[model samples]
Target: MHIGIVGAGLIGVATARELSRRGHRVILVDPEPLSGATHAAAGMLAPVAEVTYDQDDLYPLMATSARMYPDFLAGIEADAAYRTTETLVIAADAADREFLATLAEFQRRMDMECEVITTRAARALEPNLGTAIAGAVRIPGDHQVDPRRLGSALLAQVLQSGGEVRRTRVKAIEEENGPILRLAEGEDLRVDHVLVANGLNAAELVDLPIRAVHGDVIRMMMPAHRDHLITSTVRAMVQGRPVYLVPRADGSLVLGATSREDDLTGVSAEGVFQLLRDAHRILPSVWECEITELTARARPASGDDVPIIDRVADHISVAAGFSRHGILLAPIGAQLAADVVLGEGGNGPLAQSVRLGRFNHSPLEHSTRK
Candidate 1:
């Protein structure tokens, strides 16, 4: 099958990689390089720490994606020869500790395992964690991939596998005999199947309920023991605010993020300040750290806060609405879409729950609630 993916973000790259591997010709369409959420993401493949209320259906997909990452990263690392890192979720307050305990309980309900530890034990594991921390959990299975590295690797893998990547933005898509992609340069590229994975811009081509949720982040160089600063991901909820510090393989630590739904235009000074403040509270010595980089991007979110991975028209598929789960769910979403493109006509319950048209029926909406 010939598949045309209309985005170069993580979803598009993953889809291209998967489709190309499955003996399909995939043409990747996007003007910007693979540098959206994939570049800015912290790349924590964690489902237990990212859960919310009334999102049971999402857990299965997230769990499936989490289970898929080891093999996915192993394949990518073998192809790209990059280091794969582990991830951990931590708590800085008693309330957050309790919340995480409840969260771990919820995960166990889904037949997942997470190890609990005391604040002192957490600091012992990662000595840089501030003394104010209450407790932590070691989810050794949750891994971290450098999104930039992963995107570049996947782009290389896709191209090497005979997939054609066009550096052109898709203006619109129309279904005529098959799906026709209107490029930004006014060139119409037709293909057997089209997948919309353009993040927030998904609303432009189709009336998707997707919106951009703005997030601002900052990065800094790890000062002392830079190489061993953090062996795993450290996340903390300090003073009721969610802030995480992800230490990369190169001694660069990413501190993030702030969620703003009302404003999607750009980064807010207040948002950066809040993130820094929260980060400092978790690691008081961070104030002495040198600033390296600052990033701000919007993640595509939907009413249900999960991703949509279903067919729109006959050959047109919409794969946006990742909210904040794009990186964690990309592998499975791409493979499932490829299956759909190959004429396999079935979506699992979770995928059906996230389909674009699910909102139209409105029959009790168990998927939305569960």
Candidate 2:
């Protein structure tokens, strides 16, 4: 089967790789591959720390993907530079500590492994932690990965598996004979199946209930003397604003992010200032780090905040609305999309769980495609 993937972010690349490995011809189309939300993402695989009380349904998908990371990276030819570091969910003050404690209780009720520790014990693990922190929750199962590396590795795998890559934006998709991908350069290529894995731009091709949720992220370089300053990912509720610092193998730290729905106005000064200020509160050493890059990208999100993976049309499959969990959920979502493309019948539960038909109205009603 020849498959056409409309996005080159983590989801598209992973889906292409999966399809290519399964003996399908895949052509990934994207104008700026890996430059979207995947590039700005911190790549923290923290299903335990990321669980919200209201979004219990999303935990299974995230946990499944998180568990698949080791095998997923093993199969990829290019190294994605994954790290199985534990995560520390710290609290700045008493109120924040209570909040995390409540969350920890919920996690425990859900049969998740998490340890509530005192500030002293938390500081023992991370000595650089500010004295003002009240408590922390140790989530040993959470991990991190380099999304840029993952994208590169997936691209390499796709190419090695005889898949094609077109460095152009898809103008539209028409289903005359099959799915026709009208390229931005005035070329039309028809394929057996079309997977709309593009992030926020997916709405332009299909009438999916996908919207762009903008996030601002900051990348900083750790000084030579302070290399590997924080071994594990640190997520804290600093004055009720969620901030996290994910350290990379290259001695760089990713600090982010401010979630603002429908705000496409790039990174702002206030966002940067808040991130830096909260990051400094968690680890004071961040004050001396070199400010490297400030970026913003819109994550494709749905009303439920869970991903949508279903066959929206006879020849078109929609895989979008991953929100901030794109990197974490890419493997599973890719497999689901690939299964749908291959006409697999046993994926009924998986398909129904994220099916677009769950919505009241068809996404086609809102599609911008001609």
Each prediction's RMSD over C-alphas, in Å, is: 4.3, 1.4
The list of candidate 1 runs beyond 4 A from truth reads: 77-88, 224-227, 361-370
lDDT of 2 at 324: 93
For all predicted structures, in order, the TM-scores are 0.91, 0.97
Best by lDDT: 2
Query: What are the per-residue Cα lDDT tens digits for candidate 1 across 1-370?
Result: 8899888898888888888877889998888866687767877777777776698768878888877876776656432423345455667678888888888887777767677877777777778777777778777666666778878888889988999989988877776687788888888998998887888877677667777888887878877654546767778777578888887767778888688876546668898899888888777867877887888888888878878777666777768888888888987888777766675746568657776665663212221111
Top candidate by TM-score: 2
Error of 1 at 364 (Å): 22
Model 2: per-residue Cα lDDT at residue 54: 91
lDDT scores for all predictions?
A: 0.76, 0.87
Give one digit per residue, the lDDT tens place, for model 2 in 276-312.
9998998999988998999998888988888998877
